[model samples]
Target: MSEENQNQKAMPASLASVAAKHAQKQPGTNPLGTGLEARGVHAWFGTKHVLSDVTLDFAAGTVTALIGPSGCGKSTFIRTLNRMHEFIPTAALAGEVRLDGKDIYAPGTDVTKIRLKIGMVFQKPNPFPSMTIGENVLSGLKLAELKRSNTDDLLESCLVRAGLWNEVKDRLKEQGGSLSGGQQQRLCIARSLAVEPQVLLMDEPCSALDPGSTFRIEETIAELSQTMTIIIVTHNMQQAARVSDYTAFFLSNDGPGLMVETGPTSQIFSAPRDKRTEDYVTGRFG
Candidate 1:
């Protein structure tokens, strides 16, 4: 067989076109140092190592998708970025996750501030059960002890950005739990936005919702990327292609999860450098 066929050939036109959507999207004006960077990051849960030596950069005002199979540590990696991994009693991490040139794990660093600047949305929609819809959106400010001159405006702004303003605006006084699954996820997103985070980390943010909800969340992600950096972990390659500017693939050989490749979403989808990435993207294997 010729080299082209022996290895994975070019992507078919359909996927190429989907990827081409962001091919012309340029990086933000800020330097790399101004964005979030992971330098030789490693993670462990007591005796079990989950991630190894993952170093990636997420440019300012851009979206990056982490695509991999289950147990490859995609979720674990993102949790480390926001210091959420350490919340596990046995969890330990090494190396640096730097935001604006400072290590977030540095001595006496304000972990609460780091969490404030880097917001996280978990795998499921988790709006506070007791709070009203409007109250849920503005709860971050109260929990963080922040004072905003006009919470009415902030609530509307966050909901607008999350693409749920029109749907929930009339029912602001209703319980947050009254919303559907997808709407609840967006509400959680608005809750995160109330703090005005510089980076947002989403771990399977749409996995629990229906296709329509997933599409809406993707649109929200696209719009949000214009103002702040985003990192998402997804098992769905199509979602990665649709919402991300860059893509990173992680894999494991019965050991610690490792980043196999990283590049522009278009390039990663249409012409991945790593054979394993091609296999995974093409559905040949996980």
Candidate 2:
């Protein structure tokens, strides 16, 4: 057998078209605003370049999945969108991440407001152990000093959107730490929803979860996408296919990670334009 034959693996059927047809039919425009846009984005830590020239359009009310191998800079790219990357002492970045047609990195922009419009849910569940489940959901409001009437309604709405309301509604006074890991993650998501962000960034939200938990998270993601833009970094191709409207593939070749290809989820899974993407989706290489 030759090397070419050895490299060929069975291609996955078009899971996106079959599993995420509803996502594809979602309205591309959110009544809130145009989607977030990234152009010529790059990132570095001290002298080591991590990401290079990533440009993507995340339409409002849609889910875009960043699919790539570990260390391809998927998480770093999303961090830059909301200025979280600046928190790193040695982190450096270039290019523009625009929201509502304005550059987020513009001088004197309110960092807090940017974050309010673009929220993040991390890989690990980090609900505040000291706070009760209900308090944890509404913590953002107090921390941001934004006042609202009827706290109970907001708590229930956020929890409902996060798909954890039924299970935790009776347990609202209980500490967030008391919940299982899956419930804790959903609680963290509910916490993010309290402020009502227009865009949400999820960095491998389901990576640490079991199958049942992962399915619940995916369901939450689908519901969330109907109102706001969502960008998720996922290594699970099936999840990406099942949840995202669009998919971006990233890779690194002895240098900075680059966006290899991006397209509608169905097309990316069925007929990727780049060989590298096909190779990765076919399990020939990362």
Candidate 3:
């Protein structure tokens, strides 16, 4: 057998109990109606306001696309969802970001724990080069201090869940960096899934890929939505229209960024309620 095939055969199985628990849950009803909710959200970087009173809700098992012109705070806003903004010394926020009806910023909440429930995929594919494909898929579990015997099954299951098993199954021992750009991105997605997050945040996941690779990522996103809530920040208007169930438009005039319009993808693309949304989506204005 080829080296790749041998590596693939050694992959671990999926965690049937874990996968089943996640799958058995009904789609979209997180007890909060929204998997993630940002209410009265206001953000600032030192003296500069970045996000102003932004409010949005991402339903579980659905794709919510955040679209806007450059520097419109779309990426910043999504980062805030996962508490990534806290790393910026100048950043500050006043609002309620809830996951499953629980306030994320509350005093008792552990940011680390919160992050475990909310996984993020960057605009770039950032697989750890030192790890093998199997290692990458099991990276999350390595830190949990749990008994790990079904390594092969878990690796296979997570890769399959990320829609990447068929492509990389043969090379589980190969360095994660060895894959094509698109496959690496899917590997990153698989890595995130290995953690079993309830919500996934993606920032321009396909912007760096060719059309074929982009299509593959989109397919993965669509399949992922069957069990995970996905929030995507993409500058590609057509991508948003093609993959998203709902769209949120952001714009910044002389003030901080705010949502100008948000609704079904069809309406946002076909008949936007706001002129700014129409302009941005129709190539009339930025």
TM-score of each candidate structure, all chains considered together: 0.95, 0.94, 0.87
Identify the runs in model 2 with alpha carbons over 4 angstroms from their true place.
Answer: 1-10, 14-23, 26-29
lDDT of 1 by residue, 33-86 (tens): 377999999999999999999999988888999999889989999999999999
Backbone clashes counted, model 1: 0
Q: What is the lDDT of candidate 1?
A: 0.91
Q: How high a TM-score does candidate 2 get?
A: 0.94
Q: What is the overall TM-score of model 3 with all chains considered together?
A: 0.87
* Residue pairs in collision within model 3: 4-170, 8-169, 11-152, 12-152, 12-153, 13-152, 13-153, 13-154, 14-153
State the lDDT of candidate 3 residue by residue for 210-271, as single tens digits: 99999888888878887888899998877786677788999998789998888877656655
lDDT of 3: 0.81
Ranking by lDDT: 1, 2, 3
* Higher-TM-score candidate of 1 and 3: 1
